[model samples]
Target: MGTVLITGMGRGIGRELARVLLRRGDRVIGTVRDERSISGEWSEFLASGQLRMLVLDVRDETAIRKAAAQVDEPIDVLVNNAGIIGPQRQSTLDMDFEGFLETLNINTLGPLRITHAFLPHLRRAKAGKIVTISSRMGSLSYAKADRIAYRASKAAVNKVMQGLAEDLRPEGIVAISVHPGWVRTDMGGTGADISVAESAAGLATLIDRVACEDSGGFFDWQGDRLPF
Candidate 1:
């Protein structure tokens, strides 16, 4: 019934989010970096109806614009789920500079680029919702990290969405940042506490129930507001 766009649908939360949305009868346009090479549960989702994949690399501004162009159905919801964990287990002081730059490009700049391309569409919808998939590791208040690149990139995303919410309130489009919990995905690792479906589903409910006043805040999958 509603048209929703999600990025990084190839796996993890993005893939589960697409499945959940489609099962609810929403038209889900999911973004992937490759059209030909697909695998795992994601390929199964692609084979089914209610979900469609478009080759999209969020680091490419032109690709994001092209993705927005294909979203003819006045996008009601936009989820910036595309992100990278980068080279793992590197501390901030010992972090590789090149890896940090790559992480920032995919996780931080990617969301900003996509939001910019789709803001006009969201504004036209007038009462749209934009949820940026962030992490608790992003929080400066809770920041204690081994993966510096991932944490820092998500922190940057948090700030970007926070600023966007202030500017977009007048347009009636709500933008909220979410930490999907420590989900048991590739990024979250095997020791994580929550499952991907659990995180994605809970976030969906939170997004649905989000008040205008909730804009510019960061929250966990349980809908608890996190410190800035």
Candidate 2:
């Protein structure tokens, strides 16, 4: 199994994804904003070296760089999963400007910062893949006005991932944006359609099968191509 680094593994889809990868023997390097986020169940994995935890917020570039400096081995996959649902008062007319800016910083810029910091580890691997958790709400094709800030951030990140894929194509490093679907998580809410298991399972499978040829593409958790 390969080494995979996942951001925001404290809970939700990120946490579930880490569980799935770990059970299958993949080495998981999970990041959380606090040490308290580490589950006691992971003690065995931590002892065995199958799991490594990094405490840092995605918005902190310096912390990310410091964490990246501590890792000397190759990283086969980097999953940018840390994100926020954005402010409750998000709308075109009635917007929370500060919250919107924070959303953009964490959701859009955070992934890019982490990717840039850990690029060396990815380059050392045989094949590197960058997977950023994006949302279909971000699609320009959608005219929906709810959660405008979140939508805008996702759309921006999608464009960023596309450019990154193109730039890294010659190096054989793949980068893609994924819509994980509306699942029953803190961000997705309890009324959401799918379970975390379903979303995480689909994501793990999709990540495993993606190739350099699929770079710059947008896909869903089920591996279906999505419109940019």
Q: How do the residues 1-228 of candidate 2 rate in per-residue lDDT, one tens digit apiece?
A: 999999999899999999999999999999999999799989999999999999899899899999999898999999999999999899899999999999999999999999999999999999999999999999998779999999999999999999999999999999999999999998899999899999999999999999999999999999999898
Q: Candidates' TM-scores?
A: 0.92, 0.99
List lDDT for all candidates, in order. Answer: 0.84, 0.96
List where candidate 1 sits over 4 angstroms from the true fold: 37-49
How well does candidate 1 score on lDDT at residue 60?
Answer: 93
| Model 1, span 61-134: residue lDDT tens | 99888877876567778899988788754686687888889999999999899889887777767478889999
Top model number, TM-score: 2
Give the clashing pairs for model 1: none
Clashing pairs in model 2? none
Candidate 1's displacement at residue 190, Å, is: 1.2
